[model samples]
Target: MRKLAVIVALTATVFLASSCRAETVCPAIAQASVVALTVAPEYVSSVKSIHLKACQDGRCMGADLDLVPGSTPIDQGCEPGSYGGDGVCSATSSPDGTLTGMLMLESLTASLIEVTVTGTGAAGQPLPVRALAFTPRVAYPYGEQCGSFITAGVVLDANGLRQAA
Candidate 1:
């Protein structure tokens, strides 16, 4: 009888140990440090090219941004006279007359960043230089377990260079 009790206790412990285990599953994705820039339509029309200089943690990197036409997705709010209220949902791509570029950085270990932006006018004249000093924001977009990434955004508009919200 004592042997049978010992066997049952061992089985119960094994079952409980197996049931108590939890698995952690994470998404498969990659992330990098990048600075994204945007030029307002009003400003984009006047500039032919953009040159960017960025410094962080005593390291400096420079690049001429390959600005591309920017677009936004618009939700028209469903289709008319369709099955269910979901019919009113529709999306359209609209060009906002903006130009955008992304600049990859080695790292954003420092809190402070110094940036210089120079533009060439459509007529081949040099536009005024804009400089800004600001702190970048860090995020764990895929959750903390997936690691962290840093990003900075600047917009050039009629008001000149400014941090993006």
Candidate 2:
């Protein structure tokens, strides 16, 4: 009886430790607020394409998000489509040449990285931008529950945090 209890406790301890560690590992999160690509004098455009990558934890995922001229629902792509329907993020461009994009970010484990802009500038010229200024939405004090649900914003009761500059 004593031997059996020892083995059970050891197994439980290992499992719990592993689970907690997995829950704590955070990925990178960086969002692009303004995007401007000026390849040359003739190539000067306000909007092009947006790309975001979640990098870290031996994982890397990116998508060619859509760019619009105004604010819209980020969940618009919850449906199904290819060109004009499905996308990861929605960007709003200002007349002064500011691009503000939003991604709800289901899981906020530090993942919003690698912003790339690729598209044609004015006069139908190729303009690819791999570097731009990005601002990471200030991460809040977060905790997960059962490793699937979070004890934070949605289900968890905690005062939400504000964005960092």
TM-score of each: 0.72, 0.32
Per-residue alpha-carbon lDDT of candidate 2 for residues 32-106, written as tens digits (9 for 90 to 100): 332222222122243344444433334444555454333223333344557887646544433532233333333
Error of 2 at 53 (Å): 3.7
**Residue 93 of model 2: what lDDT?**
33
What candidate 2 gets wrong by more than 4 Å, as runs, is 1-44, 71-97, 102-106, 132-164
Tens-digit lDDT track of model 1 for 108-148? 65389988888798899998999899998777776787766
Per-residue lDDT of 90 in model 2 = 49
lDDT of 1 at 71: 92
Weakest lDDT window of 10 consecutive positions for candidate 1: 79-88
Q: List the residue pairs that clash in candidate 1.
A: 77-88, 78-88, 78-89, 79-87, 79-88, 79-89
Which has the greatest lDDT? 1
**Model 2 alpha-carbon miss at residue 139, Å:** 4.3
Specify the poorest-scoring 10-residue window by lDDT in model 2.
149-158
